[model samples]
Target: MRGGNQMSQLMKQAQKMQEDLAAAQEEVALMKAEATAGGGMVRLVMGAGHQVETLEINPDVVDPQDLEMLQDLLTAAFNDAASQLDQMTQERMAEVAGGGLGLPGF
Candidate 1:
């Protein structure tokens, strides 16, 4: 019947979309973003899931007389990386949704 054929076609399209979304999620999870502060004395690396991957501190920046400065730089770098990660997730989700109903997950 015509209705049955249309339903089958729609199901196939849905399955394809699901597959594409899964691929996109996988790719996004692997993406990385970095943020630095204090003239690059502190660097923060983040993954798409907003997880901190690494923290690097330049030895030259470490001064016993200015430990507070180093701490501030580390804090700023981590905050920046977290904000950037949120932006990245939003962008990736938009790309995967392709302007669809904006579902929470795909």
Candidate 2:
């Protein structure tokens, strides 16, 4: 009987953890991060899931004479946003995994 009671308690704890993880995932989905480059001539927005949501380019940055520079700015903005998104994901997943355990698929 005592063993049965312990098992039941453990099962309950596992279920609660599962619920907490699900809630955390939902919160992450609703979060976003932004990055900018080229003195704010370009901006990138990334979701918590590491997906690019938006890109903004300043009209003043438009210059046929300097298209390569504009392209570089866009790339920098995107890479910055992606780096931030990776960091956010790691932090959140660590919080979810209860200290990151370096779990698989986390």
Candidate 3:
């Protein structure tokens, strides 16, 4: 009977862990990270899921003759934003996982 009780307690612990992880994921899903490039010519905001939420390009940097420059700045900005988003998401998820799911067996 003692062994059966332990198993039951373990099952309950696992269920609680699952619930916490789900909640953490939800919070992470709504998180965002931001970055700038080309001396602030481009500003980008990226979601935790790697989605581009907002991208703002300074009008002065938009040159029709030198479109390549604009493209470069955009690329830099997006990569920076993506990197920030990745770091933020990883940190958030780590917070939930680092507790070892609060399970004694783990």
Candidate 4:
């Protein structure tokens, strides 16, 4: 029953891969990425799971009359940080998903 044995081995491999993927996801969630906007006036850090860890704004960019401008900078900074988080997650997951599985674009 060589074929049966091979199937069992394959099942084991798949189970191991699933475990690895779960671990990788947890790692990625803890990973952080950062971004800045408005010439570094707005900065933010985001986790790979899309949670904002921190945000900082330079006082010089905070105009009392320019609420819209301040809002725009904040939005841009958050979006950039989120994009970075996405990239970080993809790269980290790929390390686990591409472990000799011959999977396409893991």
Candidate 5:
């Protein structure tokens, strides 16, 4: 009877943890991370779900003669935003899971 009660309690705790994780994931999906490059001439906003929410380019950075430079700046801004979003999601998940998920190979 004691062992059964302990197992039941553990199952309940696991279910609660799973619920918390799902809620945290939903919150993170709605969060946004922003990054800029070329002195803020290019900006990108990314969601935790790895989706680009918005992108802005300053008129001053648009040069028909140097499209390559503009492309490079855009790439840099996108990479920065994606990286930020990844870190934010990971940190949030860790917090939700109480430090770590404890899964093998993470």
Candidate 6:
């Protein structure tokens, strides 16, 4: 009987943890991160789901003769935005997991 009680308590704790994780994920989904490159010539905003939410390019940087440079700046901005979003998601998940919950990829 005591073992059964312990098992029930453990199950309750697990359910609560699951709920917390879901809440954290929902919060993260509403978060956003932004990054820039080429001294702000190119900018990117990323959603928590790693989706590009917005992109801005300075008109002064648009050069018909130097398209490759503009491409490089855009790529760098995108990379930075993606990295920031990834870090933010990881941090939020870690917090939800209480630093480490034996959960895979947490």
The number of the candidate with the highest lDDT is 6
**Tens digit of per-residue lDDT, candidate 1, span 1-106:** 9999878877776787788788878877888889999888888899866788898999999999999999899889988988887788778778767845334574
Candidate 3 Cα errors over 4 Å, as ranges: 101-106
The number of the candidate with the highest TM-score is 5
Candidate 2 backbone collisions, by pair: none
Model 4, 1-90: lDDT tens per residue? 999987888788788889999898788868888899989999998875678888999999989899999999999999888888888888
lDDT of each: 0.83, 0.80, 0.84, 0.85, 0.85, 0.86
Off by over 4 Å in 1: 99-106
- Candidate 1 lDDT for residue 67: 91
Cα lDDT tens digits, model 3, 1-106, are 9999889887887787778789988988888878888899999998866888899999999999999999999899889888877787788778777767455686
Comparing 1 with 4 on lDDT, the higher-scoring candidate is: 4
Runs in model 5 deviating more than 4 A are 99-106
Model 4 regions more than 4 Å off: 100-106
Instruction: Report how far off residue 2 is in candidate 2 (Å).
Output: 2.8
lDDT tens digits, residues 2-48, model 6? 99987887787788889999998898889888999999999899886
How well does candidate 4 score on lDDT at residue 81?
86
Give me the displacement of residue 34 in model 4, in angstroms.
0.6
TM-score of each: 0.77, 0.79, 0.83, 0.83, 0.85, 0.84
The digit string of per-residue lDDT tens for model 2 on 1-106 reads 9999878877776777787788877877787889898899898898866778988889999899989999999888888887876777678767767833233664
For candidate 5, what is the TM-score?
Answer: 0.85
TM-score of model 3 relative to the true fold? Answer: 0.83
